[model samples]
Target: MTDNPLSQAEYDAVTDAAAHWCMRLHANDCTVEERLAFEQWHDAHPLHAFEYEYEYEAMLEIWDVAGDLPRPETVAPMVRAKPATPWRTFGIAAAVCAMALPLAAYSGWNLGWLPDSYQHFEANDNVRQVTLSDGSQVELNLGSELTFSNYKDQRRITLKKGEAFFSVSHDTRHPFIVKAAEGRIRVTGTKFNVWMYEDQVRVNLIEGSVLVSSNDAVAGDGLRLEPAMQASYRRGDFTPRISQTYDNDNSLAWRSGKLVLDDLALTDALPLINRYLSKPVMVADNSTGSIRIGGIYNIKELNNLVASLPKVLPVYLTRNKDGNPVLNSIPQQAPKS
Candidate 1:
């Protein structure tokens, strides 16, 4: 009975319809009329029935690989005597549960219910822009990922990795909170940039005020921040370094596809540059790595900078056995008296 194969467009249409039917059945107040309508729609065409079955089976396969997917508390009982409710509805529900598992295992944040409960946003290799449920806007930098979990008490975000710029919506009743490995940031409403990686977390405020606190500290006792200010926390440190000033444009330069560094150390800057390149750039010695350099770099065109670094600094590039480039320091010349 499942002989007919559907085209991609036809399959998508059928699956979409099946999904809607699944939601209606799962709705708490699903009426008998809706159930009857669904029965009619399913019986209207053989292709419809087949597509629904295909979707259901696919969902089961996903469930096999992805554990503990969420589902509605209850679904309305099937009204028709013969050919009960399509398993497609169950599969779609299960697929929704498994949607976030593929990346969760590796990302270090795995609460099985997050895929169903939280809103997820990610930018892979290139910058991405998204609007939050509360009308707030977010720009995710390359390779960054974050999830939003909003509740009646507060709006919380778990920044998994990389950096993100948030233009928060004003909601005094429910304050906004961002939690990273480094610490937690609390604000009523604000515009800010957060970079989280390894054991380091940096929060740069462009506008609005935020309270920065250690992961274990109470929000009331966190450090209060103002515009153009930055707070950085290192792992194992008792407190975060706050009240530092930063150039707003420099902090947010990634939005314009540039890496603008103001005399940042080569060692420190390579990490940022490595985020954009397919291969990593490394220094051979402390001297080469410690050289302070400042320039606006085109992240997309890194080859030019890597080729020209030797001329400006007392450093030279050499390839390893694997042909990966490494920067080594040149002999220090005698200083002029």
Candidate 2:
């Protein structure tokens, strides 16, 4: 056996190869020929044998941690004595522990034992419905974006922007969580409408109860909404402002291809209205945006609303340099001189 030290790349390659062989030999479907091949490879080089022993010990430790092990009778015989090098053992242990975490995490993720990262979904200028793996249905409004992940203990969803209606399936063991802006809504099974404005989130519960809270982990530090109740909160708020009675139909009218506005500021209304339009409309100044408006307008017929804006409110529609419509407040008439 050569006493020369291995370069970093060479050592990594040998360790990786040894780990691969160790996993292959431990597999239930390992064949006689494969075992012979591993034996031959283990004896081919001193480094190979050393790395194999280290990886085998590492695999055993991993299996112990994972609570899965091959039968004692079926265990393969060790091909060589473990080296008594203290530094080498320490290095191997550290590397094995580091490797074990990611390996175990990947396996757990595949087996549905761990939470998955976000899987993004978006509806740009059109409404769409998505069914999750847990059989929950989400109806995304126009210009909306959402992300979701199903963990073993809980199913989580984040409303990144715009609005969505959730029809969650019943699963008492796994609580359903919806996060929007600074708030979190937790439920077991429920149908609800969640609207995410620029800096606020509105949740209107149609059926089932939901606990809306801030990011804090304090127990009972939130508001619980019964069916037909609505709650809203701005970013950074500790608790949502509850509305015991709300216009549920108006809140969900966007789902039926309509935009319902009731004394809502033009600033707030433009964002909802622009979701249906190919070209977005912008206000010239705050005065145009501050105008209070109310209407039930067909989303498909947005042009009608643009034409009627001047007649209903003190605003005029004009085109910007980019050809997008801009709403400007009409100048008040001067008194007779």
Candidate 3:
């Protein structure tokens, strides 16, 4: 035990730094250099190192109790310590499954976010985890625009762009509905993630279930998803269908700030990247529509996504006047020795 006991000043400093890093990471605009800067800041001080380790252990302890952020588990403390507990853990269960009576404690803030400053985004980009008044939790992905309507009868969200994982509070009358790009997804129970673009939509179900349908089209043709399931819809397509199944881990892992793309195309990739950025990444030619790129990237940064190609294909990535990223292919040079 390096130091099981921590003073208030030390504890505040640690959680503050940890919270900044937490918020910075959620902003997801951090460059490699920026990430390195944080690492240096964390390691520079002995107190910082100890607090980070302890806070991490505290984070893991919290996760161990809750399983995840969206669907937090109830974790009541077995014992109280001299210092105040900084974490709150909750309990959640899968949809349509019998749940055991949880020996769970319900305390601490789920994520150490200021209530007054909780929902606002500052500097660079922000991914906010918002807990609605009704009790449903939403982790708004980077560069995401989330507006919640807390009405006496209904709760609604309009995701302008980017992605979000919703652990909807089970309110039958409220019926949480998300409106995005000519489609609407309604859920009563369980947890799911929805990724939206100008022309396409993707939904992945981790635990529980959800009903996905096109608001622009017939609801009858909409698809339903269970745990480990995914669905996608593109404009001009005939119907929506269940296309893939990702293990809950792979499906909901982005909550930890990773991008999960499954053999998506450059054309498809463009809008996804643009969702997290202010400036659009325009692909000059539509002929390259089928050029494919895959793998989970930290939607937090654009560098990894730009690294998808090399050799033979000429690709250019640069920041423009408006500070948006533009990606297009350059004419390949003739082979030279």
Candidate 4:
């Protein structure tokens, strides 16, 4: 309803609130209830209603900017940050233009590198199990961010951010490679997970070993992580530590909407909780943030998780200003020590 929008200031206010509501709605974890409430709230005032619709429409346009382009129906969501500029242009240009991305990138790739086409995957909010031209299966985890790049000889899977698991169907010709946070993971055939957030990068080998090195090969030295081994790499160095290992039980359960908090304290579980929901989660105090908790909870069912938390911690979950979630853990006063 830009026809008669709200005052500039009013429009900004409503639109900003609406954007936040969108995130809240997303984190609502399920159903259109939040969206419905938002609609009602937006329509409460003429100006607010108009601004809401205008912003909503803008969102649709930005999303459909790649109008009618063939894209994977569901993909692991990426952080709500800007996608590469180059990909956006390609999206608009390729829509319905008899577009055919190299299907080989989805099939059997051999000794050679991935083509430039794979560099830009149009993904969304679901795990993308991609078969490289070499027959390697690369499963991109939820919200895991990555890009594709094609070199003359080696196919590259660049974990721009987030995480992914590779269950490579071995091919001797082409060595499977994963790139993340200025580090490189290379393996011939095996299962492994690469998690990257900012400079925190880790590689967990599930089945086979991978030769990992800092992307800055000139200055960075990585190492081989054998099965059940994990390493944390930052600033181009791997903090030598045996990675956590799991068997028959669900590994990477997040992909299945399950959060396995293994004997994790409330404090320890905070990070995973924050990651699952779109909205932010924080502890009110550092002391509370350090509490450990353990148990498994379905990612979509937060109430169960919340109700169970109290039994496991000396804290309460409270809302902060601006509606962010904060944990407030209290303990019995110690007798005059």
Scored by lDDT, the top model is 2
lDDT of 2 by residue, 1-337 (tens): 6788878998888877887776666555779999999889899898898778766764453333233223223454465555434344334333434343455444554554333333458897678999987888999988788867676677878787889999999999989988888779999899999988677788989999989986555457378999888898888886789887556458888889888898999898887777566777889999889999998887668867877888999888899999988999988899999
For model 1, how does the per-residue alpha-carbon lDDT over 1-337 read when each residue is reduced to its tens digit? 3677768998778768876665566555679999999899899887567655555444443333233444344423323222323344334544454342355443212333322224667898688999877778899988798877565566778788889999999999978889878478898889999987667788899889998886654435478889988888876556679867745448678898888877889988887776665566789988888998889987567667888989988888998887767999989789999
Candidate topping TM-score = 1
Give the distance in Å from residue 313's predicted Cα in candidate 2 to where it truly belongs: 2.3
Using all chains and alpha carbons, the TM-scores for the candidates as numbered come to: 0.63, 0.60, 0.52, 0.57
Better of 2 and 3 by lDDT: 2
Candidate 1 wrongly placed segments (more than 4 Å): 1-3, 6-117, 217-221, 246-249, 319-325, 333-337
Put the candidates in lDDT order, highest first.
2, 1, 4, 3
lDDT by residue for model 3 over 1-337, one digit each (tens)?
Answer: 3546777886676767864553353333558887888789877766665554444434333333332233223343233232323231111111101122222352222222111111222212656777766688888776666655443444556666667888887878757767666666777766888887676878888777777775556646267777777877775555556866734335455567776667777786667666665556665566555567667777677654554544423566665677655556677689998
Model 1 backbone overlap count: 0
Superposed by TM-score, candidate 1 places the C-alpha of residue 253 at a distance from the truth, in angstroms, of 1.6
Report, for every candidate in turn, its global Cα lDDT versus the true structure. 0.72, 0.75, 0.58, 0.59
Candidate with more favorable, higher lDDT: 1 or 4: 1
Which candidate do you rate higher for lDDT, 1 or 2?
Answer: 2
What digit string (tens of lDDT, one per residue) describes model 4 on residues 1-337? 4576557787557756755554354342536877787778867776555444443433333333332233333333223333334343333222212222344334212322123244444234666777665566677766666655443455567777666777887765656777777677877789988876556676778887888776555544457787877776775553334455657445477567677877765555665665545555678877887777777787656545665666667877778787776778787798995
Q: Residue 159 in candidate 3 has what lDDT?
A: 67
Q: What's the CA RMSD of model 4 in angstroms? A: 14.6
State the weakest 10-residue window (summed lDDT) of model 3: 89-98
